[model samples]
Target: MSSLRLVPGTPDAVLSALTAVLDGRGTPFAPVPADPAAAARVRQAAAPDEPLEHDCAVVLTTSGSSGEPKGVLLSRDALIASATATHDRLGGPGQWLLPMKPYFVGGLQILTRSVVAGLAPVVAGDSFTEAARRLTGPRRYTAMVPTQLARYLDTDLDALRSFDAIIIGGAATPAPLKARSAEAGVTAIPAYGMTETGSGCVYAGEPLDGTSVALDDGRILIKGTTLFSGYRLRPELTAEVLRDGWFRTQDRGEFMDGRLRVIGRVDDVVISGGVNVTLPTVQARLLEHPRVKDAVVLGVPDTEWGTRVVAFVIGDPGRDELRDHVAETLPRTWAPRAVIRLDALPMLASGKIDRQRLLEELR
Candidate 1:
């Protein structure tokens, strides 16, 4: 067994070590190796005299949800705990297919799990069929964002069901997509978590083994052994989010039927006439409509009410009829005051709804 440690070093060293490991070559395991003579330097320079921890093995970059990247320190134990929990939840680890890049935390988790599970992950290229063929045997797993899942749905159902379970994360999966996936015999688990929580603490709709979830001031708080130590060199930020050993995620969620349902970012909510409106909830409901293929909701400036709830939908339907359809099921206030029909909804590179871009287009 190789002992891992965190050492203060440069990106070249870190990359070299990663390359070595990926190529089956051995390298020193340290959180930050201080010696310039070491095989490789850390990705980020470390202070020579700074206090360094030896147990941390993985350094994850924040998702930049709040517009700035932060480094998350993770110990080997934490990463293993997360992978083990996922394996247990999925009923044993098998072959994994990576349709996404490994530089991301989600992708890294898949690669790490493959290594931990003693299996090599198949990287999908131009051929989806080739990827499906690699997923041989009884158990198979893959991780994809909602957009990828949607795109896969547009492809072949047989290829989509090739996996035993597909963990969907990186964004809120609309209810319609989840339903369609189940109908297609694909086990699509909508995951909720951030880099601070070591990928996803909640899977399907429940917290993984040993992970605890609670709400503090409408913000979801997660506490678990898998939680990252803190943002690297940003004590103020780390203190702001981490309190009482719980990571305060910006996301707001509710617990229903013993499962967690993430509503949206707390800031994503808009208040109109003193009524709080969750954009994601409205979009989710809109997606439930038979004609709507995709939907995104945002708040637009309104003179009468502080902000008006506006929705951009990708589908063909009369605005009144769609409004009535939404009003019939959801609360009247939750219904979008204005529906902007669009050929398609804007998406981020991570496959999330680009609300900022949509708002710009609407304006």
Candidate 2:
């Protein structure tokens, strides 16, 4: 049995190894960030010496937002399929900009897409304009989390409009940002997928060409060539999710007008004051306010309410105003009971909202 290898090298170095792996010339490996703290969680989940699965191209370590971290094993074929389909969906192959960390699937897919497109990726180092200037391809693209895109929309419109398409993944984007992007002539594509699906298989509410999205009792079920092979050295856990070629997602969504509408995770609902409050719904409503930049709605333990709904936000929206905002579209009981304002939302290396850290803040 061949052991899994770990690559904690610089971007250029990791890209070299990744190129070989995708070409079937190198062994199976996991690319981790160079930052000690960010890379530490990946190190704990990646069993470098453990036996690797056959034909495994990359093992992406996930911090599991809520649960323990796990290594998601993806094959070379799946990664290539996802990249190629992404190019097809976006009109054609083009150069990509790597704005996020190089290790996670969101950033890793940018590198993979570049390799598939036969173009070198331009790394966006602090300045979006500098990176946009480096793009030599006729068609240009980049992927960003909601937070990064929100910042760019406020600071740089010319740079944001330079790209043909900007894939927004990592977390639920604020409604205000979407309106601003559209009004500013920036084509921001909302993406959905996790490391287990070889990055975003569904872009802007539709499944990519080789991917299929179905509803399993209102739960999201995806299957296709872009799917991960299994979890690294954890077949039992892998069996729990991947069944009969379909990967069960924790999210519950519905399709209206042929486009998938994600309705938050299955466990996203909490009973507060004898009412079912969907956290994402409340969070989405909070984000619609023009003054609100970003928001995260969560349910905490409570003796009276069973689970007290709280809103941790970054912006100038007051408690009463936010509560009134939710009551406008949603039930009045769905409003968050407590409001906690923060300078910025906690983010993980993968560009996902660090829910664990946010929960820690409440403690």
Candidate 3:
């Protein structure tokens, strides 16, 4: 029986524990946040008394956006496979800049890649520019969400461009943001993957080496060495998603020009006014508006429409104007019927919109 340890989820602590686990010198551990509530949840999920399976390296939890977060178990082999594939895609790893919290897959993979490269990662401390200066590698890489890129572009263009490539995941990169990154010569690569795939296996719409992607009725199915072993203590849940060598993902995707184009989540589509509407389409249209900086579109339960299309927006855009803007490209019924303007969207610690919080506002 493999013992599980609950390591404190600090960059140094988690990194140290992870290093030991990867080196086969320590017990299988779960990194728990220092925050009381979050730590409790992680501890409960990990359940250290329950022995882990063979070769389990580290266990990480999901963002728990929809509901209860599940613990994802990853073996040392899977972690090494992911790091090797990432290095192959990124012109061989030199050194990584750790900008995100270490507990999440994106940040964890940065450390993993650095380990595989036999190079120490430069943690992007309070100052990104200072951290960029410390990257002594021939090839530099970092991972961040869309929000961080926008902020860095506004303040530190040179530092942002210092890296050979920047991996953007955890959320959709707005079209405007993508254009800005390109214009700034930032070499931002949009990645698509989740905790299940052990971080991103696809970058810039291309699957990395040792990773295979297929579509099942428009749903994205991934099969590769980068896949996680199973959900810790959740056998039934593991069997539900992992079939054969393929792991089923909930995101909808399409092959466009021989590249995997992730449309959105499977549940992003909702029937409003008896017409099916994809919320991301409406969200994208709102983002294209000059006056709108950001937007989140959601379908809410309503008596009249069965499901009402609602939008939470940032920037100074009028509800009617935004609705008309969406209608210009999409069907009139697909446009958000209700629009709530906000100064800024609430974000999770993982750099994703707190969508469940947005739904709470409706209640």
Candidate 4:
């Protein structure tokens, strides 16, 4: 049996090691996270066993926003398929920008796609916006989560528009952000997928070629050539998610005009006074307020209402005004009972909002 390889280094070194594995020259690698605890969690979960699949090429660590980190096993064929389909969907292979860390699947895909295209991806150092300004290419592309994109909206419109395509994932891209990108003539694509489905099998609410998407009672189920084999060292967790060739996502989705629309996570719903409140819908309404830059709605324990809908907002909107805003769009009970003001939401290294951390803050 081949030994499991652990790689630790800067972004460039990580990309280089990932490329070597993709090129069938190096040992299967598990990219290390910057956080010591996260890195150790990945290493613990990535320990090799006799039942491990021989074809595994990469072991990716999930962001663990919802739970414990699990190493996702990606075979060579799956990685290739994901890269091929992404290029095919985006017109063709081109130069890429590495604005995020290479440990996550999104950043790793940038390296893999660049290797397949025989192009060197531009690595951002210290200042991503500055690096983006210096890049010169005919067909340039990059992938970033909403947090990174949010930081560049006003000052980097020109830099953003320079790219042929900007792939946005890791979290839900707000409607306002999408509008701003469209108005600026930036070809921004919102992707929906997790570490389990390679990088992203669905772009802009549409499944890519060679990928199948369906809604099973509001939960999103995806099956594709790019799907990971399974979770490393967690057969029970893998069995719970992957069944009958379909990966059951925690997110809820809907179909409209033959396109998929992500509704939110199944765990995002909470009962308030015997009525189900969807956090995403409430958060969307909160974002509609001009003063509110970003918002995360969650259910906090309340003895009176079972679970009261509470919102963490990043703007200066008044409690009454924000409550009235939600009440206008949704039922009164759905409005957040309380609003907690934050300068900025805590973010994971992957640029996703740290929901678990926010819950801890409440406790």
Q: Identify the candidate with maximal TM-score.
A: 3
Candidate 1 C-alpha lDDT tens digits along 1-363: 234344333333443444445445543343343444321323342222344343345665443435654557666667778888999999998888877645456776777677777776777888776787877645889888888899888885778887788899988888888888998898888899777787888997799998999987778999998888766567788789889988888888888998888878878888987898877877777888889888877888899889999889889877787778878877787778888889877764445566677777765
**Stretches of candidate 4 exceeding 4 Å from the true structure:** 48-51, 133-137
Taken over the whole model, the C-alpha lDDT of each candidate is 0.73, 0.87, 0.89, 0.86
Q: Judged by lDDT, which candidate is best?
A: 3
Instruction: List candidate 2 stretches off by more than 4 Å.
Output: none
1 or 2, greater by TM-score:
2
Give each model a TM-score: 0.82, 0.96, 0.98, 0.96
| CA lDDT for candidate 2 | 0.87
lDDT by residue for model 3 over 1-363, one digit each (tens)?
Answer: 888888888888888888888898888888888778778778877778888864588888887876788888988999999999988888987899999988888988899898889899999888999999999988999999999999999888999988899999999899999998999899999999988888999999999898999999999999999899988888898899999989999899999999999899999999988899999988998999998888899999999999999999988878889888988989888989999888888887778899888987777
Local accuracy of candidate 2 as per-residue lDDT tens digits, 175-200:
77788899999999999998989899
Give me candidate 1's TM-score against the actual structure. Answer: 0.82
lDDT of 3: 0.89
Q: How many residue pairs clash per model?
A: 18, 0, 0, 0
**lDDT preference between candidates 2 and 4, better one:** 2
Instruction: Give the better candidate number (2 or 3) by lDDT.
Output: 3
Question: Candidate 3: where are CA atoms >4 Å away?
Answer: none
